[model samples]
Target: MDKKKISILNLAWILILTASLSFSGCRTDMQEASKTEEIFGTIVSVKAYGENAEEAVFAALEKAKELEKIFSLTISDSEINYVNQNAFKDAVKVSDEMFYLVCRADYFSRLSGGAFDYTIERLIDLWGIGNDWARVPKISEIEPLVGLHDYKNIVIDSQNHEIKFKTDTAMLNFGAIAKGYIADEMKSEILKHGVKSALLNLGGNVLAIGKKPDGSLWKIGIANPFNPSSNIAFVEVADCSVVTSGNYEKYFEEDGVRYHHILNPETGFPSKSGLAGTTVISPVSADCDALSTATFILGVEKSVKLIESLDGVEAIFISENGDITYTSGISKYHFKELN
Candidate 1:
């Protein structure tokens, strides 16, 4: 063939090949892979979607179970509870998971100005507030045990990944922050397994790791502190976490006074703030959980200011009578559904 004819033939074949490859690529899309699966339980649950979802959910569930063991104060065999129970007498060595949780708790202790403390495990046990739902401890009964509470004395050996409570009486409780930690861990597990889109809910604490296959943000409902059946606001978020702590979730009323969890560390009493619920949004669920619980105790003006000072935290407080307040940063994300 002539040189001109040869060049023309080569150009035609290249165009045809490009068209065929594009068509083939379209046929095998991200949608063709298996969608994820879902598993639900008391303390932890996960819902995964889009290609390989079943295996993804299964893997997520196993991770959730592992975290549940790590976070559970009820599991006497668990490292966390063991650390709490034995801290007051001798230095108790902790597993890597327990060490991570303790470090987070230590960080939050400084963050809350000591108002939010997990070392009050003795008080929690005396009051029997969480899980077993302890009744109020006699003032005398709790005051002495309070000596067992010591966060500063506790030491974490980060190099070896072991922890020791300086005193045997010292106790640690992850109740105020563990759910968020687990949510964070679960998301990490899913992401490691190539899960691009998943939603993790650990006892109402919600996290959206990525966007849906259709390119829409996940809609997460913020539960009404007063109404458990439906949420008060729906937040559209992706790659973020929203955690809510309420005065009403687990509490028994006595006479005219309402005694709920989220106790005040100073008085060993439930916070007197008129706020009933507080929700925090941040990049990590652990910080979000701690801030939400601590903000509820801090009340309106202080809570608002505290949120403002943080780099990437925003909070909302709902007054007992139904008034809604939120930081300027998150006003757009909050919706008032009280009619």
Candidate 2:
């Protein structure tokens, strides 16, 4: 063969190889994998679409279980249980992850003016709304526990990674934000495995990682407080978290009076802020989770103002009268009202 003919043949072979590689890449990118597990007191699911989707989802689920062990108050040997049991007597050293979450919880506690409290475990136990024992307590029984709902009682030493309580009666519970925190951690784990698109639904708290495989935003539904079976609205989001706190979840009726789990730390009873539910959207899942509860307690006007003041935070407040009020930023996300 001539030299020119030989060079042309080599170029053709190179093109064929390149096309084969590109086609293989596309096939891997379209693959999807998902896994669901009951952990952290809720059903957590992780889904990913890409070459490493299965491994990423599995790893994320494992991470969620690890976090549950560290944060679960009911777990006998968990770090949180240790702190709750011994923090009052002596400063209990906690894991770095636990210390960071406690600090963040305290920050939000102060930010929401005690509306979102971590030191309300005593109050939660008294009401037992979502616990094995669910019932309404007498006024005298709830009144004493009211004073124990103070977040100020928590003493955190970031330098030493220790936590202590000022009062022996005080307890710590991350039930409000644990799922969100675990979801955020799982997102990190999924991305580390080279998953560019994923969705994590920790119970009702949803976090979308990057965009969908089709390059479209993820649509998350906001549950209707009055009718838990239906959605009141939907928000399109990407690389963000949508969290809702409502009276409809974990509530029981006694003598025609319904008592919910989202209690006011100040009152030791379910909040009566004239709001049915609050949904918050933010880049941080934990922040969205805490703010959802805070905004629900803050009511419509205050919650709207608070969300507006914070950068990259948006909220939807559904009133007891079935009216919806949302922040300006959420409008661009194409929020649709169903009812």
Candidate 3:
């Protein structure tokens, strides 16, 4: 092995070197190393097609941690959390990145007609819908909290980078948009480091930044909402984002009814819309991710209109009963079946 080749810090480059060594008829025990990943409670597997892909994966993980630190509501000092925590106590100025995100959240809240809101955290915790043990909150308990979560009330002073809530009870949570942004940011940073291709499969939110090693399009799978483990369809594309928002994920059952995490801002409860899931494919995975949640909250009719208005974005809607609906663009890239 070339000592200089080993010094390449990018994992994608490293993997290529490994493969070339194998193809060149050289014998070396498969290089092995383990690095703990800090995002989503799972150690992300790093693979390389060229060289230094291990370093790229580790770098991605590092980037994910930085995002986590900035966005975590659990942390008292994170700008978003700090603003929410300090609301009605004292005004706190935020960083420009934090300021922009707060502004973006506000804009999306308005764009989606308040369907996409960050202040739904109180209701989320009350129902425990995202957690393993789910509990139902009484209407009495939720009614008061729902009144507090008006996204229009999130006042952003862009010039000063300060944000404040109109109501004392309102708090912020970035469950919908944070992961997609992290993936998108990681992709940009990875590319800047000279990697031409990288695939990030964050649970089901998949983004392919570059072409495959064979110079073909990247093939990504869309998980069936009906069955979490299996995919209902596959999409072949390069440099696109495929994000799914489903009623099946993060849900709980009580008696005979099932409750899921995606909530209606109006009612502060699981949206009763008939759609099962919605996938939005765009150049921006982060936007697709956030809009998927927003579109689901908007229901089928409104979501269809939203997708149509956006350029270069395609969509697929999966109904609660497994009816598949496709926009013009996604129809072209659809995979017929799996072997």
Candidate 1 vs. true structure, TM-score? 0.82
Against the true structure, what is each candidate's TM-score? 0.82, 0.90, 0.84
lDDT against the true structure, per candidate, is: 0.76, 0.89, 0.74
Per residue, candidate 1 scores C-alpha lDDT tens digits across 1-339 of 699999999999999999999999975766322222232224556777666666776777787678777667766677676666665565566677788878888887777777677677767667665445557667887666543336776787888776677765567777888878877887888888787888878777888889876778877788888886778876777888999989877776656666787887767778877898998988899999888888888888888988999888877789999888888888555444544
Give the range of the ten consecutive residues with the poorest summed lDDT in model 2: 142-151
Q: What's model 3's TM-score?
A: 0.84
lDDT of 2 by residue, 1-339 (tens): 699998999999999999999999988658899888889778888889987899999999999899999998778899888888898999999998899899989999888888889888877888888776889889988887774556888888878888889987688888888888998999999999999999999999999999999999999888999998899999898899999999998888889998888888878889999999999999999999999998888789888888999999998899999888999998877788986
Q: How far is 227's C-alpha from truth in model 2 (Å)?
A: 1.6
Cα error, candidate 2, residue 7 (Å): 40
Indicate the worst ten consecutive residues by lDDT in candidate 3: 26-35
Per lDDT, the best of the predicted structures is 2
Arrange candidates by TM-score, descending: 2, 3, 1
| Evaluation by TM-score, superior candidate among 1 and 3 | 3
Looking at model 1, report the run of 10 residues with the lowest lDDT sum. 32-41
